[model samples]
Target chain A: MTIYENKYRITYEAFSKFSAKLSKANDKAELLEIVQKHLKYFFNFKYFRVLLKDEVFLKSFHVFHNSNNSPEFILNEFFSYEEDLLKNHIPIQHSSNGEFLNNYDQKLNLNNGKLWAWYFKYQDLQLCVSLISDDEKPFIVRDIEILNLLIDSFVTKYQQIKLKNRLHQKNVNLKNAINVIEEQKFQISKIVYNQKNTIEQRTKKLKDQNSKLAEISRLNAHNVREPLSRILGLLEIAELYEEKDLKKEIFEKIKTSAKDLDHILQDIIYKSNNAIEKLSSKTPPTK
Target chain B: MMPDKIKIFLVDDQKIANFITQKLLQTSNIDCEVLAFDQPIQALDAVEKDLPNFIFLDLNMPKLNGWQFLEQMQKNITSKVIILTSSSDPADVEKAKDFPQVISYQTKPPSREILQELILG
Candidate 1:
C-alpha cells in the first residue's frame, strides 16, 4: 500500500471504534460519557457543544476538554454563536478568544481560543454544532467527516429515547379515554333501569283505578237501581187493578221499595264523604 | 197445541227482582206458567231439563255471571233470552249483541210494553 492509503486506513479504524462505542450507549448519561472518552481520537477541540431541537423541545449539550471535565445538558438555553449558525445555516468562525469561544478559565487550562460553528439538519432534527480550539490543539478541516458520523450516532440515540417516551404517553391517554366511555355506559344503563321501575309503578296504579271504577259501577247498577225500577213497575201495574186491590197488593210493595232506595242512598253518601276526607288528608296520593 | 201454556223462566240473582217480574206478568193478565229462580245454578238445571219458551236473565250475579251462563248454554240453547238488568249502562246492551240466543235487551223492572213485545209479539 502507498503511505497515503495507510494513513487513511488508520483514521477509518479510529472512527469505527468510536462509532461502535457510541452505538452501545444505552442512555443520555452513558452516551455523553462515551462521547467524552472517544471524541479526542477523531478531532482535537478545547470545547464542544451541540444545540439540538425538534418540534417540542430545544436542548444544548456541552463538553469541556480541560482534563477535569463533564458534559453539560441544558434545556432551552443557547449561545449567540449557535443562534447565528441556526438562522444563517452557515459555518462561522471567531479567530481568537472572541465572545463566540468557550469561557472555561482555570490554572490548568492554558490555551487561547478560536471558535468554529456549523448548522445542519437530519430528518426532523435541527443541529447547531460548535467547537473551540487554540493554536496548540487545532480543529482541522480533514476531521469534519469523522465528527459528522459521531453526531449521526448521537442524534439517532436521542430520537429513539424520545419516540419511546411518546409511545408510553399515548398508551396512558388511551387507557383514560376507555375508562371514561365505560363510566358513561354504566350511567346510561342505570337511568334506563330507573325508568323501567317507574313504568311498572304507573301500571300498578292504573290497574288499581280500573278495579275501583268497576266496583262503583256494579254497586250503582244492581243495588241503587233495582228497587227504584221495581217501584216504577209496581206503580205502572196498579192501573190494571182496583184501588182497593192495590191498597192490599201494590201499596205495601211500594213502601218496601222506597225504604230500600232510601237506605242505599244513605249508604252511598256516607262512603263518598269518607273517601273525600281520605283524599284531602294526603298531598301526593299513595298507590 | 198447548200454545196458551207458555213456559216462561225468570232468572235473576235477586229474589225480589224475580218476584217483581212474575207479579207484573200476572197483573198484565198474561196466560203463561211462570217459573222464577234467584239462584242461577238452579235456573240452569231447570232450563236444561225443560227448555223455556222465553228466558229472562240478569247480567250480574255471584259465582256465575250472565256471560258465563250463556257460554255454558251455548251448546244447544234454542230458547230466546231477554236481558233483564237494572243497569242503565249501554255497555251491557252493546255486549248482549254477541249472543244470538239473546233476542232482546231490557232494563228492569221491564216496562209492560217490553214484555208484550217479547212474549206476545
Candidate 2:
C-alpha cells in the first residue's frame, strides 16, 4: 500500500476508536480522560492544554492539561488573547511566529519551539486547545482539520450528557410528587371512616332515647288515668247525697282521690325531667 | 212491700274504699245485705262457705289481687262480679271481660247511680 493510503487508514482507525470511548463516558471527568488519551496518541507534544468556558455560567472555567507542572500562567494568557479573537469572530490556528505566540511560549517556557493553538465556539461553549513541541517541524493544515473534527464530536457528546442529567433530575421530582398525593389520599379516607363511625353511634343513641320517651307516654296514659277516674267517680256520688253526715263522708273521699291524682302528675313530671336531663347531658363527638 | 234481700260481698285492700263503698250501697236504699272485707283472703273464705248474689272487687291489693279472687271463685261459685277498681285503663277493662263471672267494670268510688243499677239488675 502507498504511504498516503496507510496514513489515511491509521487516522480513520484512531478516530473510530476515540468515538467508541467517547460514547461510553458518562460524566465530564470520564470524557476528559478519553479526550486526553486520544489526543496524546494522535500528536507528539511536551505540553497540551484545553481551556473551556460555558456561556450559561461565564465565570466558571474548566481546564484540562497533560503537563507535569500546573498550567495556570498559560490559562491566564489564553483567556486574554481569546477576547480579541472572539471580537473579530475569527477561528485561530497559530504556530510559533503568530501574534500572542510569545505569551504562551514565555509562560510555558517552550524555548522558542513550535506551538499549535486552536479556538472553537460550539453552541454555548468556548473552547481552546494548545500544544507545544520542541521539534522544529511546524503543524500542517491536515492536523488542524483533524483537531476541528474531534472538537465538534466532543461538544456533541458533552451536550448529550447534560441533557441526560436534566432528564434524571425531572424524574426524581415527579416521583416525590406522586408519593405526596398517595399520603393525602390515605389521610382523607381515614377521616371519612372516623366520621361514619361517629354518625352510627349518634343514631343509635337517638333511637334509645326515642324508645324511652314512648315508655313515658304509655305510663302517662295508663297510670295517670287511674287516680283521675277515682276523682270523677267520687264527684258523681257526691251529687246524689242529701244528708249532711253522708255528704261530709263523700267530701273526705273526694279529697283523698284528688290527692292521689296530684301525686301521679308529680311522678310523671319527675320522669319527664329525668329523660330531658339524660338527653341534654350527651356530648357531641370531637375531631 | 219490701223487695227480697240481695246478698252482696265487697273485697278491697283499702279500708277507706270498702267503708265508702258500703256507705254508698246503704245510701242507695236497695234491699240488700252487704258484707265488706278489706283483706281478700277473708273475703275468699266467706265466699267459699256462702256464695253471694253479687261481688264488688278492687284489683290493686298487697296479696291475692282481684283477678286471683275471681279465678278462685269462678270454678265453683256462680256469683256475678262487678270489678270496682281505681284503674280506668281499657286494658284492665278488656281483661275483666275474660272472666265469665264478671258482669261489669267500674272505677272508684262507686257512684249511687251505678250501685242502684247493679242492685236492681
Candidate 3:
C-alpha cells in the first residue's frame, strides 16, 4: 500500500475505535477522558486541553488536559479570550512569536510554541479545545479536518449525556409532585373524619335533651292534671250540696288540690331552668 | 231496663279521691251499693270474691295500676269497667280501648249528668 493510503487507513481505524469508546462513556467526565486519549494518539502535541461548560449549571465546567511533561496551563488565565471566541464560533491561531502569547502569564511555556484554539456551541453547551505544539512544522489543512471530525463526535456524546441528565431531573420533579398531592389528599380525609365524629356526638347530646323534655311533658300531663282534676271535682260537688257544713268541707278540699297543682308548676319551672343553665354553661370544642 | 240496687266498685290510690267520689255518689241518691277502696290490690281481692256489676278504675297507683287490675279482673269477671283518670292525655284514653272489659274512659270530676247516664244506660 502507498504511504498516503496507509496513513488514511490508520486514521480511519483510530476514528472507529475512538467512536466505540465514546459511545460507551456514561457521563461528561468519562467522555472527556476518552476524547483526551484519542486526541493525544491522533495528534502528538506539546500541550492539549479541553474545556466544556455544563448545559444545566452554567458556571460549572469539565476540563481535560494532556499531562505528559507539559507545563501547567491554568484555565483562569485564558478566561479573557472566551467572550470573543464564543460569539464568533471561529478558531484562533498563534505562531511561535505572535503578540497573542503576551496575553498569558509568563510562567506558562506557550512563549515558544504554535497555538490553535476553537470555541463552538454543541447542543446547549459551549465547548473549547486548544492545541499547542513546539515543533517547526505549522498545522496543515488535513490536521484541522481531523480535529473537526473528532470534535463532532465529542459534541454528539456530550448532547446524549446532557439529555439523559435533564430527563432524570424531570422524573425526580414529577415524583415529588405526586407525593405532595397524596399528602394533601390524606389531610383532607382526616379532616372529614373528624367532622363526622363531631356531628355524631352532637346528635347524641340532642337526643338526650329531647328525651328529658319528653319526660317533663309527661309529668305535666299526669302529675299536674291529678291535682287540677280534684279541684274541679270538689267545685262540682259543692254546687250540688245544700248544707253550709258540706260546702265548707268541699272548699277545704279545693284549696288543697290548688296548692298541689301550684307545687307541680313550680317543679316543672325549676327543672326547665336547670336544663337551660346546663346547656348555656357548656362551651363548644375547638378544631 | 236499668237494674235496681246496682253493685259498684270504686278503686283509687288517693284516700281523698275515694272519699270525695263516695260522697258524690251518696249525695246523688243513686240506688247502688258503692264499695270504695284506696288500694287497688284490696279492690282486686274484693272483686275476686264478689264481682261488682260496675267498676270505676283510676289509672295511676303505687302497687298495681288500673291496666294491671283490669288484666287480672278480665280473667274471671264479665263486669263493665269505666276508666276514671286525672290524666286527660290522648295516649291514656287510647290505651283504654285495648281492654275488652272497659266500657268507657272519663277524665276526673265526671259530671252528675254523665254518671246518671252511665247508671241509666
**Tens-place lDDT digits, model 2, residues A1-287:** 99857865887789889999999989766776677677755545555556666755432122323332322322243455456555564555444533444443334444455655666778778776666565443345566766777788888997798788888898898888888889998999999999999999989977887787776786687566666665565665565677786557677776786787788888888978987787667756466
Q: Individual DockQ of the candidates?
A: 0.43, 0.30, 0.58
TM-score of chain B of each: 0.93, 0.94, 0.92
Which run of 10 residues does model 3 chain B get worst, by summed lDDT?
B14-23
RMSD of 2: 8.0
**Candidate 3, what DockQ?**
0.58
Tens-place lDDT per residue, model 1, A7-62, is: 55876788788777766766677777788877777778877888988787889887
Off by over 4 Å in 2: A1-5, A42-78, A83-89, A93-139, A202-210, A213-222, A229-255, A267-287, B1-121
Top model number, lDDT:
1
Name model 3 segments beyond 4 Å from true.
A1-26, A33-47, A54-90, A95-113, A122-124, A133-139, A149-153, A156-160, A243-246, A284-287, B1-4, B19-30, B71-74, B88-98, B111-121
Best-first order by TM-score: 3, 1, 2
User: Which has the better lDDT: candidate 1, or candidate 2?
Assistant: 1
Each candidate structure's TM-score, on Cα atoms with residue i matched to residue i, is 0.60, 0.57, 0.76
Docking class of 2: acceptable
Inter-residue clash pairs, candidate 1:
none
Give the 10-residue window scoring lowest on summed lDDT in candidate 2 chain A.
A59-68
